[model samples]
Target: MDFVLVHGTTQSPAGWDRVAKLLTAAGHRAIAVDLLTPRDLPVEGYAQHARDQYDGERPVVVAHSGSGVLLPAIAEALDARALVWVAAYIPDFAGGRSLRDEASAVLEPDWIGVDPTADPAKASEFLFHDCDPETERPALDSLRLFNPAVLAAHPAGAAPEVPSTVIVPTRDRTLRPDWLRRAGRERLGVTPIEIDAGHCPHLSRPAELAAILTGRA
Candidate 1:
């Protein structure tokens, strides 16, 4: 199967490198897209950008972190086979809330706002705590300051009718694991698959993530 890997905020397509390589080695096509900048573009535009990255068959669209808000739109645009959320925020289509609003309501006030690109030390500690320095270095370097408007933008339309899987990084320090579990059950309507990894599982647990992506886990 083919896979479209979308990275989270403050991240780049390079974050998906290891997982993509593993999937490609297993005879699956995986394209990690750079979710375009000028972040104020309509959510549909972001979806279209991701779709244009792969010309292969319909894929399993996987979203990480902030990219989750755009997942439903992206899945619909690509006519994806499935939707996968890895340590990602699951949006409520009916709520008419922005990612920031939703996150603030459930998360501790202090956790709600922080620029990931502002502090490399803090970013590494929260996002890559389970990762080694080699993995942490590039991820930190790749952090880009996305517009705050992106978080304030709401996801458009209802979630597409498709099979969806949410993978919770059990040891995640960034997005609280307990909050993720509640969000997965309440919004996505499914129990999440748990992985013993931190926020960036693609970097921290590539082989295991690849296994889950390939349906081997």
Candidate 2:
């Protein structure tokens, strides 16, 4: 099966490197996208970029962190087979809360004007506290500045019409596990697949993460 991996805000395709490598080694195709930047683009624009990356194949669309809101649009555009949320923000459409609003309530206080790339120490603490030095260092070094505009944008109208799964990192400090569980249940209506790792499980536990992705776990 094909897997189109979408990284969160400010993150590059490199974030999926380890997981993608493992997926390929196991005989599945993995396509990781570097989300469009400047964050000024509408949600549709982000979805279009994701759609454009497709090679005319209906892949399982896997989104991480803030990119969850875009899954509905991208899935519609690509006719994706399934959707996977990895420690992602599941927008509450029925509750009338946009993904940005939900995320801002949790993340904006600390991240608003801070440049992730400029403050490796802070970034490391927020994103990689559970990661070992070897795993955390490179991630910190590659951190990019998050686009404020993206955080300000709202989600698309409807929920994605595809099979979906939510993967919650049990030890995640960035997006607390309890919050993710409530959000996943209320928004996506699915029981989360819990992983004993941090926010970036693809980096911290690639083999385990890959097993879940491939339906072997």
Candidate 3:
């Protein structure tokens, strides 16, 4: 299957390198979109941008971290065959809250309006703690500031009706697993598939994550 991997906030397309490579080795095409450029898009705009990255059969759209908010619209734009969320936020369709509000308690205090780049130490501690030393370095170096406009805008539209899978990193420090579980149940109405890794499982557990994404796990 073809896959479109969407990285989260303050992250670059390079973050998906490990997982994308694994998928490609297994004979699947993968596209990791560069969502940071023209860093002025809202949720819908990002969805369209991701859609434009590929032209082929409906791909399985995978979302990581903050990129989760883009999935609903992306599914529509791409007419996605399936949606895979890896430790991602499943937006509350109630339309009253923003992604920042959903992540406020878990995110660092200075996550917004202060610095666009992620602190190296914090990224090590929270996002890449479970990754290999080599994997963690590139992941950290690839971090970039996200579109602040995305944080403030509430995800519009209901969750897409495509087949969906939600994977919760059991050891996540950035977004607690308990909250991930609850969000998966409450927002997406699916029991999350748990994995033993931190926030960036694609780096720490690429083969395992790849298996799950491809339904081998």
Which candidate tops TM-score? Answer: 1
RMSD, candidate 1, Å = 2.0
- Return the TM-score for each candidate structure: 0.91, 0.89, 0.90
Q: All models: lDDT?
A: 0.81, 0.77, 0.78
Model 3 lDDT per residue over 1-217, tens place? 8998888876888888988899999999999987766457766787788878888778999988877878888878888898888988778776547776766754544433433264688777777788777787787887776755675576546767877888999888766678778877877788889999988898889999999998832
TM-score head-to-head 1 vs 2, winner: 1
The model with the greatest lDDT is 1
Instruction: Rate residue 108 of model 1 by lDDT.
Output: 38
Model 1 has an lDDT value of 0.81
**Cα displacement (Å) at residue 164, model 1:** 0.4
Error at 204, model 1, angstroms: 0.6
Q: Name every residue pair that clashes in candidate 1.
A: none
Considering lDDT, where higher is better, how would the candidates rank from best to worst?
Answer: 1, 3, 2
